[model samples]
Target chain A: MPFEEKFHLRIPGPTPVPLRVQHAMNRPMIGHRSAECSRLVQKCSQRLQSVFGTRENVLIIAGSGTSALEAAVANTVAPGEEAVVVVTGAFGDRFAKIADRFGARVHRLDIPWGEACSPDALKSFLLSRPRVKAVFLTHCETSTGVLNPVRDLAQIVREHSDALVIVDGVSSVGGVPCEMDAWGIDIFVTGSQKALMLPPGLAFVAVGPRARKVIRQAEAPRFYLDLQAYQEQLEKETTPFTPAIAHLFGLEAALDMLDEEGLENVFARHRLMMEMTRAGIRALGLPLLAEDAVASPTVTAVRGTETIDATALQKELRRIGVVVASGQQHLKGKIFRIGHMGYCDPLDVLTLLSATETALHRLGKPVRWGAAVAAAEEVWSRV
Target chain B: MPFEEKFHLRIPGPTPVPLRVQHAMNRPMIGHRSAECSRLVQKCSQRLQSVFGTRENVLIIAGSGTSALEAAVANTVAPGEEAVVVVTGAFGDRFAKIADRFGARVHRLDIPWGEACSPDALKSFLLSRPRVKAVFLTHCETSTGVLNPVRDLAQIVREHSDALVIVDGVSSVGGVPCEMDAWGIDIFVTGSQKALMLPPGLAFVAVGPRARKVIRQAEAPRFYLDLQAYQEQLEKETTPFTPAIAHLFGLEAALDMLDEEGLENVFARHRLMMEMTRAGIRALGLPLLAEDAVASPTVTAVRGTETIDATALQKELRRIGVVVASGQQHLKGKIFRIGHMGYCDPLDVLTLLSATETALHRLGKPVRWGAAVAAAEEVWSRV
Candidate 1:
């Protein structure tokens, strides 16, 4: 059995937190406005700018990832504005819904669930919209395990429309490279739970000068989600509100781990894990939800075949103390997802494959002992 | 010396978490939508309702205390509506500001900084603002350390105005008795950092039937702050957004501790600590910001005199590895606040008082070496 509590967590988010990070978060609480907390906030915020690939300061909000997503919408598009959202999966639909909730006329450029939105498609979508104020894109759609080409889509948005390029990098940042300035991303948002190797609480938003200026000018009804207030407070080396202080402690440790590993190596490791997971699943004759060209390095969705029930497979895996995520929204019970980000390792992936092979065979599928594990081992050795 | 990390934490919020709760939070991460997570959420929320003194479900928000305050305002007051806000201190002013940000015509019922809103004053204020759609009150003003007479004020609101009573119980709920239904408060909110013995991340909002109805009907633009959707998903024993799972683990442990202590005993313990703190401060010939009757049980603010500088005294205490809160906003540097809630014992308070005494003497005040500690001990023995 896996240590520290029981089940092996292989979800897209709320990923495994390292022991160092957990120990860091277990430190005693301190005054939020004290000098020590100020230093912690400033240092953590500074270190995070590198992961986001932005020179601008990242605003840390003590909220869920969706709070950052909603903040992006609430600060930019005012009532009666026109915004374009690329809908590729559940999170994409969420951005569009958030925009619509904020009274903006949202034009969703829907792409196939398992496919990335092409640059040409985004360009044509923007051309038709004519007066789009902002364009929202998901860097990694967790629901379908599709990694949209955000850089290309953002370039198209810049060339075709005078709109703010907002990208939800909730499941992308830290596990992958995000060149916010280079990609012309006006606003980029990410969560702590995915590749940051911390639990879910903090949401980081990197706002470029253009987005900050627009946020300052926009007259939206927001007090807690106000980004401008966060900026003003950051100049004082403190937060606008009481931050998730323990999470910051964990964040400092997580950042140290990421720094020690080096971000480039971290991304490469995630890629290797992804390759391992895909190979093992494919060796079991499983159907992948996303094309290899557009597959997410963080999470891989494996569709259930007619012979195998995804629900039963998930349940069997759970019985063996292996926990992978089931499909979300409309795809529920039809597919399962394997997470390969954050603190996950090759040995952990091998164990998961070994367990999955047992689960499938136990669920009346053809017996294929050692095949899945061997396939993953082959990928690991090749890498 | 205080163990775990270093200094003694005496801030009003981000209170010192118990080691047990910290250990609970340090448990391994798990899939957010798994059956185990759902069970944790249900059990934690169920245990929390008793502390809130409500039969309604206490919605757990993965955000700051400010987020819950804003959620209450956003869910009830529509744009261009009229509301009455009783501004007693910083938090009360924050509620008024949130209403103003949300485009409501807010009539501020300003009270003196160190005083609570009297029922007569509130009745008169409500009578004058007959068309007020909602009335916002702060149950505990953390800045001034004033615990308002919420039960009485809420009664007056029900009698005099057709307004929904929304209370910011951020610093009050877990430390004091909050009879939400009996007090006629339509909405009540608190945070994990205060008397909950957890870090600053989760916000709990207990919504009454009236508030829920109004929230569903209110036309304010919100997605992440929308409480109705939270209720809908909660029927399935899950949160609408990804919750702070580690905090939920901590919450379960904290609630277990609270339950084991028995809530009445917990409240009395906080009361005893308050009496000890106030006695110790008075014994040192220091002035308290709030009067004895309205002084908060969770925190107490000590004002500076002509002979002593509050800032210098605070720095001296910090030199001895003790941490307390400086006054916020206009009161900064004039007063230093001592928190006596959550995971704190009489021994902690005695140490805090003793450290405070040494700091006062070092700051050139005529200090009797054992006077403050003796006074606190007397109170503890009597209680």
Candidate 2:
């Protein structure tokens, strides 16, 4: 009686949690210190470690992925130190702000919102700021659907200095390949909602041995976001604080689904969805926000013409039970994003595109009647 | 096959999340800026106001309840600001550490573990430091199962100085009556995993007008924990940063469950569980951690004889499909805690008592056979 409608999530995150995952959360709450809870934590951590591409400690925090990002900055970059941040979109700039707040001398290598950061530009920035102790980059910027080459940037950082390479993989990890250990990524952070197919409230950070060494030498006063303390307590199979147990239960279930699909297949599926979505958007005569080569496989951002308000179109899509997200801040009016990350399929994309064509028509924007859906259906039929 | 075992949670916090609540998390993922997500933010805020007992702005954070505590200290009592903290158990010590981390000139009013902080002591501390800008206290210390007299403490804080009254109601909110507006509480925080009968990860902090004004005047280098920023963004019905969407979904479900039961009935049910648990412990000649009057209705901490290692007994309970928590840190070998909050019933108490008796017997500790269960049944019959 409480749930009158079964809403299908077509948006980027808070993706439709599978029934099995929901049932996972309904498990009896065990004492956090109990052996059962610890075993779950341990197993969960291992699964996360595999996704983050690290053998080091991967800690789960009771908050959104941003909390994990904040913890990484607080623990790695100390006061009075310098951090070179490659800013591509809202999330990239967020790291700059967080690093600055922690007293880091932040040097921002700013780029256009929809464009990806150039690896050469990053190399130049690293050379200019040799004293920088850290480099922050977003692997996949959710705001504009641009995927930055973190592996290339990591190589640049390694050649330039001993600065730790930290990647905000919030929307990318499960959607694509992330080889943390092989790529020499020191600190990688992500959220549960995006590619993990779980709810928010759980964020993960895997700290490499090099990053752990930096944390030991750093001098920033931290209590709750202290990764070292969290890891120390975690080694004993306990959290320094009480964890969100239900979210973890859901995460375990989400992981089971991922395991069955296989990480490689999951990545390939996302790529397939990405190509289908892009083809559908192109068929509608719309401009893609990012260049195809650097476009993210998780989400696609389409540039809207002057006559159409992306915000209004988003609302129109919602009215028909198809929800799409608009751009953030300065990019709000220029672009509308469609996410096809975790738990999404070709049919879901077709539904979104069909509803989108209808919404654009209602907004008096010119569009070929059924072109978008036709293009999407072509991809779906093949699959 | 994914769900090999079906579990029904009867633990204190992280209680069995209702099916409706679990389903709520399955809502379509939307961009944080989508109209639907904003409506969710607005509706959830209003619902949270009712639970927090204030019309003030409630900010939701992704972390354990401790993260909210850190935010309270980091946001309100800026560096070098004078503050007083009342310590009774594990959570209380965490408050002190959080204050210390932020460079607050801290003053502590300590009550022995498992005991309640006295209003007189708090009053005296306030008198000693008239310049204290805030006073931190916990309404319920789940670690030792002690519930402090918040109304009395609030009255004392009012008479002593203008210091903001910040109460941690993490484990108390729905299980106890917390009149934040009536008591002039400036900042009140609680987690979903406690009496709210939801999972962890999402923590809510209600900031009154007074607290908001204080935030404007305070100076703390905070980005992820900038509650002031959350307040501003929440006006638009969204978080300043990405939120744990699924956890919020689960919480909305939890709020509905509480509303159906009514707060008064929720409190009454908890009280009954406490009485049943306490009577059983008393009948077994086991001592309770806190004084009878100040004992928390959420959890009952029973002092165990030295021969019975609390941790070992707990492990044994888990081996038999029953789980209970041991005291934290120094209290580890001293007491065993039984949680009766959230979804727990009299039958749960009976099972725990029976398990405890069996565990104690195996550990060479003397126990009157079946006495604790008889005592619990008698008390439950009266209820």
Q: What share of the true interface contacts does each candidate keep?
A: 0.97, 0.79
* Residue A38 accuracy (lDDT) in model 2: 93
Instruction: Give the alpha-carbon lDDT of every model.
Output: 0.91, 0.82
Instruction: Report the lDDT tens digits of candidate 2 across residue range A187-292.
Output: 9999888898877778889899899898877667788888888888889987888787877888898888988999988988898888889988888787889999
* Cα lDDT tens digits for candidate 2, B276-337: 88887787677888888899989888787556566687667666556566777799778878
Clashing pairs in 2: A9-B28, A13-B29, A28-B9, A62-B63, A63-B62, A63-B63, A244-B200
Per-residue error for A363 in candidate 2, Å, reads 4.1
User: Against the true chain A, what TM-score does chain A of candidate 1 give?
Assistant: 0.98
RMSD of each: 1.5, 3.0
Best by TM-score: 1
Count of backbone collisions in candidate 1: 0
TM-score of candidate 2's chain B against its reference?
0.94
lDDT digits (tens) for residues B299-382 of candidate 1: 999999998888888889988878888888889999998888998888999999999989987777889998989999999998
Tens digits of per-residue lDDT for model 1, A171-222: 9999988899998999999999999999999999999999989998988888
Q: Which ten residues in a row have the lowest lDDT in candidate 1 chain B?
A: B1-10
Predicted structure with the largest DockQ when compared to the true one: 1
